[model samples]
Target: METLYQQQARVFKALCDPKRLAILEQLRTGEKCACVLQQPLDLTQSGLSYHMKILCDSGLVESRQEGKWTHYRLSREGREAALDLLRQLTTPDAEAQSSGCACRRGRE
Candidate 1:
C-alpha cells in the first residue's frame, strides 16, 4: 500500500514532464475536450491519450464523458497538494536565507 506522500510523489512526477505540465496549464483555464489539448500541443492522438492516462491515474486530473467526447480538468485537491508540496520544498531554503526573503514576506 502506498503512503499519502508516495501517492503525492507519483502525482508530482507526472507533472514533472513538460508536456504533462502544459496539459495541466491548459486545463487551468477550464475543462476541455481531449481534442483541444491535442491541437494546441500538436501531439498525436495516441501520445495525448498516453499523457492523459498518466495524469488521470495520478489523480491530478479528472475526466468526464459526454456522448462521444471526453472532457478533462484539474482536480482542486491535486492542485492544493502540489502547491503545498512546492511550498514545503522551498520553505526550508527560504528560511535559511536572509530574513528579508521574498517568500517569507508572502507568508507573513
Candidate 2:
C-alpha cells in the first residue's frame, strides 16, 4: 500500500502538468467560473471539468456554487504548501553567504 506521503506525491504529480499549472495560475488572480477556464484554455467543457475535478480531489482548488455558475479558487493551504515545498527544494547553501542569504533578504 502507498504511504500517505506517496499518495500526496501523486497529487503533486497531477499539478506538475503544464495545463493544470496554467489553470492554477489563472485561479490565482481570483475566483473564476468554469466557463472562464474553458475559454482561455480552448478546452471543451468536459475536459475542463475533468481537470477541475482532479484539482479539487487533491485539495488544491475549491469550488462554490453561485446561482447557475460554479466559481473555482485556489485553496490557501495548498498554495502555501506548494511554496514551502519549493523553498525546501531550493534552499540556498548556508556557507555560501557569510553575511546573510538571498531568501532572507527577499523576505525582508
TM-scores vs. true structure, each candidate: 0.70, 0.68
lDDT of 2 by residue, 1-108 (tens): 877677467457758778889999999899999999989888998889888888887778989999988899989887677677668657986777477677888888
Q: Which candidate is the best by lDDT?
A: 1
> Pairing residues by index, what is the TM-score of model 2?
0.68
Q: Residue 56 error for model 2, in Å?
A: 1.3
Mind sharing the TM-score for model 1? Answer: 0.70
Worst ten in a row by lDDT for model 2: 5-14
Per-residue lDDT of candidate 1, residues 41-92 (tens digit) = 9999899999999898887899999998889999998777778887887676
Deviation of model 2 at 73, angstroms = 0.6
Which lDDT value does model 2 have at 86? Answer: 60
**What Cα-based lDDT does every candidate model obtain?**
0.87, 0.83
Give the true-structure RMSD of model 2: 9.4
User: Once model 2 is optimally superposed onto the true structure by TM-score, how far is the C-alpha of residue 45 displaced, in angstroms?
Assistant: 1.0
Q: Residue-pair clashes per candidate, as listed? A: 0, 0
Show pairs that collide, candidate 1. Answer: none
Best by TM-score: 1
